[model samples]
Target chain A: MHIVICIKQVPDSAQIRVHPVTNTIMRQGVPTIINPYDLFALEEALRLRDAYGGEVTVLTMGPPMAEDALRKALGYGADRAVLLTDRYFAGSDTLATSFALSQAIAKVGETYGAPDIVFAGKQTIDGDTAQVGPGIAKRLDLLQLTYVAKIASIDLAAREIKVERRSEGGTQMLKSRLPCLITMLEGTNEIRRGSIEDALGAARSGVLKWSAADAGIEDLTRCGLRGSPTVVKRVFAPAARAEKAVQIDTAEKTLRDTADELMAAIFTRQPALEHELAFNSGA
Target chain B: MSTVNRETPRPAAGRAGIKKELPDHFKDYRHVWVFIELERGHVHSVSFELLGEGRKLADKLEVQLAGVVLGPPGEAIGNAIAEAFAYGADIVYIVEAPLLADYRNEPYTKAMTDLVATHKPEILLLGATTLGRDLAGSVATTLQTGLTADCTELDVDTDGSLAATRPTFGGSLLCTIYTLNYRPQMATVRPRVMPMPQRADKPVGRVIQHKLSITEDEIVTKVLGFLPDSQSATANLAYADVVVAGGLGLGAAENLQLVKNLARAIGAEYGCSRPLVQKGWVSADRQIGQTGKTIRPKLYIAAGISGAIQHRVGVEGADLIVAINADPNAPIFDFAHLGIVTDAIRFLPALTEAFTRRLSPHNRDKLAS
Candidate 1:
């Protein structure tokens, strides 16, 4: 079985800081890493390859710098890495990004072997839009299973795969055919550490770089800002609250005293909550 | 608010100056539609919340608000239709089929895209639940329309286009997005982002029944079975009246018990920050943050959490927020109503003991003092 896992490089959101005066993201010093959610997908794909004995290909659509993410995946035992990068693909939203990525995936199928499965993260930290995986599935006409918490079983002869999909209040055990797209939920598995030899091999490996044209994207308009239907009208910081929090004195007070004082302050502020708690405790 | 950036210009240069007329084909697209998500036998409350929001947008655009229900033919669907009307829908679209009994992408997508094609709705709103996201993504892609996910706010601009606002840059910034040229501008709102609309006794309105054209054999994905989460594990944190959340400052996984003990003493739900979930100490559903559950409890007690913007956005809506941390400069204090700069590990048990003593049946009267 051949599996293609799509990944993205995003700024480490935890390290990202907003400029207080300018109210813009301070992008200069923010380091980039593989989108955290995508790592779970990569690790899952690597595990499947290990068990089922198939090739795993890592795919990403971003600027040239995204090669680092591909190489990192390669270190994690991905057999091949493809970087779909082009200036034309800039400013693409989920719809356009999925269009480009789907085209690239189709190209991967033709160049490499046909893949039985396509994997993506449930969502990206930067965009946090979980639409691209399904968009790719629709464009490629593949079955889509999202928020998959576990791969329960795979019947290679039947070309069937079963997974436990995370739902609102429960888990749904779903079975789908091969050549399906899956967006993996986070914390499903811990990514493995690469062996020293594998890390060395990844460092020397040359990523297969593809432009939009190389990825079989014929329609340039649909490749970028021109194709994207959604337009960002404005981005700004949420207004700060008028007043800062009131500090409860804890320096000289004992822990019990502090707790009592805090409770008193809370009851004073929200008398209704105190009454509700009283009613609840009495019951 | 100072506008930091405009990420994308309108598609056409000249059309950008004026409110570009929607293609003549899409001009006929009218009304707003909310996909009423029916799972198991109960309708998700997020659907009703979206209807509440859709009501406002529908009224603003001078269009009818419609609730689209696609489920098996049963009391669930029937009750969902009635609830939609009582919530705010002026019209209800029904597509009942056994194929749609459990949400498979193929049939549900077919039903929704067919509904949009036949009776055009300019805007479509869905809850950002697992099922909704799965359906919305496929439907929007098939129709080649734009869809924004996890929107915190939705409104109609002066030109009558849907302006969907959501947190960006890890909740440090907010961006307003518009699907200018697409018909049925689509968006999904997280469960608790919008206020639940007041339900009223109203007669059901016009019902438009559509056909699900796909057969069971045509669908590739099948539901083998469903395992409902155990009652004790489910975190109904989004709608809880009182919430207590812990973060990495708790130091160890076992210390999460402090958070739960306090919560139990006060009859509140307990949760943790994203890191604890990432650390596998807590379940994903109990995470309180931008990528997790958004909550608006009456009283929120955050212990040991240095509030990042992501976590702040989720709980900032609480009526009263009390933050306890070892460091005085933790960001949680910035937005909290009351803050105690004390170590949560040491202070939690004392607070729990105090609440247990103050709120016990014999001492309940003391709370009033």
Candidate 2:
């Protein structure tokens, strides 16, 4: 059985700074890390490989520096890595991104085998859409099990998997057959550090790089920026409202006195609040 | 509570601003359609929310609001139609079949897209749930239409176009997208973001039974069976009237207990910032932010939260917001109703004491007796 883990290289949000003039993200010199969520996906896939005796392959589509992420995947016990990068792939949305990734996974199938399970993070911190997992599951015709809080069981022989799914009000235990895409929720598992031998093997291993044509995508028009429909016409910082709170100064007063003053001032500004408070003070 | 009549698609406007004058070809597109996402016999609430929102959009455009429900026949599909109208829909289109049961990308996608092709809608909206996101992506891809996910704002422009605004690039910035050239503008909004409409006493919507041309063999996937949640985590988050959510404040792992103590004292639920889960101090289910579960409790106490735009989008639904932080200039104060320029770790205990004194053992014992 072959397991595939899809990851992205995103700028560390803590290190990211916005360009005040252009109102655009300043990626310059900001270090990139494998999406924090994706690390869990990689570790989960490695755990499956260790238990099931299968090979794990890491896949990513990004700039050349993205290969660094794939190598890191190898250091984490993945058997192989593939990098799908091209100039034409720039400015791709989630839809276009899933297409490129699905094509790359298909190419992997030819070189290796059809993946028994494809894993991805719940979402990338950069996009925060969580759509790519479903998109890839759709394009590849794989069963999508999203928001999986735990992999309760996986029966490789039966090609079946059972997991707990998170929902608005409760968790749902969902069971589905294999050849599916499962997007693991974050904090479900801790990522393991690579062993010295694994790190050495990863440093020496070659990363497979593919252009659009190499990934078996026949229509260049349906790939990257062209395939994306929703165009971001513009992006700007949210304007801060030019208003201040009515400061209730009570430095020298007691809590009860301050509370009374607050109620008075609040009533002066919003008489309606007083009515609601009175009505709701006790039902 | 019968289904409403199936009306013809509303006629498209001709020679409008920009929009390329609505090509002589597309002047035929019309109808306000809600996608009733069916799971087992039950339906998701976002479906109702979309119906409520779709009703408003339909009224503004002066078109019939219809719900497109697909499920297995004799599996309570009609009940969903009544539920749709109870929430505020005027029409229902049902395509019932065995293949459509137990949401699979292939069957549900085929059923929905086929309905839209046979009967076109000017606008379509779905809930941004896991199933909704999965099914919407497939349906939109099959229909070759534009879909905006997690939209915070939805309205009609002067040109009668769906103006959709969503947080883009991790919610740091917002971008409004317009399906200027496309018909049946598609969008999905998360649950709890929109207010629930009052259910009508008598739902008088016309139900138009739809034709399911596809069959079981045509659809490849099977439900097999569903594993019910062994441990439910979602219910407590949604129904809690009072919630104490900690932001980056509360300092470290040990400090999160202060929030928990306050919550315990006030009989409220406790949650934390996204970074807390990232830090392994709390479970992801306890995180309260855009990426995490959204909460719309009546009273929300945000301690030490800096109120980043991403986190702000998640908690905007809280009715009464009280922000406590060491920094007076924190963004949380801008939107918070009650602002305190004090340390949360210290102020939290004090507020907890205040609330405890106000509604303590004596009051609780009296009420219980």
Candidate 3:
């Protein structure tokens, strides 16, 4: 089995902030991390490779700096990494992104082997669109499954796989054919720490770099801002509330006394809540 | 696949092109359409919520608002259409087929995409549920149009373009997107983000029936079974009156017990911030944030939550929000109605005990008398 996983490099959301005056993102000092959600997909791909005796290749599309994210995925036990970077790829929305990635995955198939499964994070923190995986699946004509909680089983001979797909309030047991695309849900598995040997091998392994032409993208108009239909008109910070939170002074009161006072304050503001709670509690 | 039109000239020189003209092929697109999502013989509330929003946009554009209903050939489809009329649809499009009985990507995508091609709509809205997201993504790709997911606000701008506002950059800022050059501007809004509209006693409006041309053998994927969550395990966070959530501020996973204790005592739903879900302390279903569930409880008690922008947007709709955290400088304090700077590990227990004692039968009976 050959498994391909798509990962992205995104700014650490914890340190991201919006400028109060200009309403623009403050990206000056923010460190980039392998979109935390992608780690789950990477870990799941590695686990499948370990169990099935195959190789896992990680893929990403970004600037030259994104090679760092690919190397990090290699350190987590991937066999190879491929980076698709080009000036024409800038400003590509989710639609253009899926086009570039599907083309690159085809290129990977020619050089290495055909991938049985294509994996990606459910969504990206920066884009938060969750549209690219499905777009890629549609372009590739693969069976697409998003929000997969668990892989129940895979029968390579029959070319079938079963998974528990997470839904609104329950799960759906779905069966599909191989060469499918999956967007793994977060927290499904913990990413393993690289061993000393693994880290040393990852440091020496070079990532295969590809440009738009190298990846078999013939249409320049379809690779960048020209291909993106959705345009961001304006970005701004949400208006601040005129009133700040009313602080409850815990300086001079015991914990018990503060709890009592807090309850009093709540009931004073919303009198209907007391009766509603009483009704629900059967008090 | 080239979108460049040789016949139509580009906008005149020098000025920035913020409002691009609609392409000639897409010029006739009119009405606002909402896909009414029905699964397991029941219509999801998010569909009605989108209709409510769709009504406002339709009125703004002075166009007809329609609900697109696709389901098995049965009374469930009829019932869903009737409910769509009650929720404020000027028209309802029905596509009945056994293939669409359960949502497989193949048939439903074909039905909706074909419907859009036949009768062009300027805007298409869908619920951000599992089925809706699955179907919307495929349909948008098939139509080669732009789609925005989990939008918080939707409106028609002065140029008559759909302005879809959603949080971006991990919810730190809000951006409004426009599909100016595409037909049928599409978007998905999650449950509880919009208020459920009041149902009026209105008859079903004009019905337009479409055909589904796919068969079972054509679909590559099949639904093997359905596993419904146990009644005890399901948390109704979206519609709960009161919610109690924990965050990473809780030192360890075991500390989540404090949050559950308070929730049980107050008859509230329990949840956690996004990081708690990522840390494996709680399931993804119980996560409250941009990527998880957006809740609008009447009262929200946030313990040990630092209230990042992602988590804040999810619970900000609550009427009364009280935040308890050890750090006084936590961002949660900025929007919470009541802020208490203290250790949640110690304060949660005290709050639970106080609510228990105050709401006991003995105290209620005495106060009533």
Top-DockQ structure, candidate number: 1
- lDDT per residue for candidate 2 within B1-369, as digits (tens), equals 000000011123321232446556556678788888777788777788788888888899899889888888874787887788788888888988877766666677777888888788888888888778777777776665667788777888777878787765556666666666556678888877776777785555788777777777665444444555545544366557678888777788899889888777656788887777777888776877667667787777788988766677777788767777789877777777777676777767766665555455565455446
TM-score of candidate 1's chain B against its reference? 0.90
Candidate lDDT scores, in order, read 0.87, 0.74, 0.86
Off by over 4 Å in 3: A20-22, B1-18, B326-329, B367-369
lDDT of 3 at B227: 85
Predicted model 2 interface RMSD: 10.6
Q: Against the hidden reference, what TM-scores do the models get?
A: 0.94, 0.86, 0.94
Candidate 3 clash figure, as a count: 0
Candidate 1 yields a Cα-based lDDT of 0.87
Model 1 spans > 4 angstroms off: A279-283, B1-19, B252-254, B326-331, B365-369
Question: Per-residue lDDT of A1-283 in model 3, one digit per residue for the tens?
Answer: 9999999898887788776566677779999899888888999998999999899999999888889998888888999999999988876767778888999999998889989999999888777777888888899888998889999999999999999998766888999999999999877888999877779988999999999999988998888677778777666677656776788899888999999988888888888887677556664
Residue B33, model 3: lDDT of 99
Residue B206 miss distance in model 2 (angstroms): 2.1
* CA RMSD per model (angstroms): 3.0, 6.7, 4.1
* Candidate 3 displacement at residue B69 in angstroms: 1.0
Candidate 1 is graded, for docking, as medium
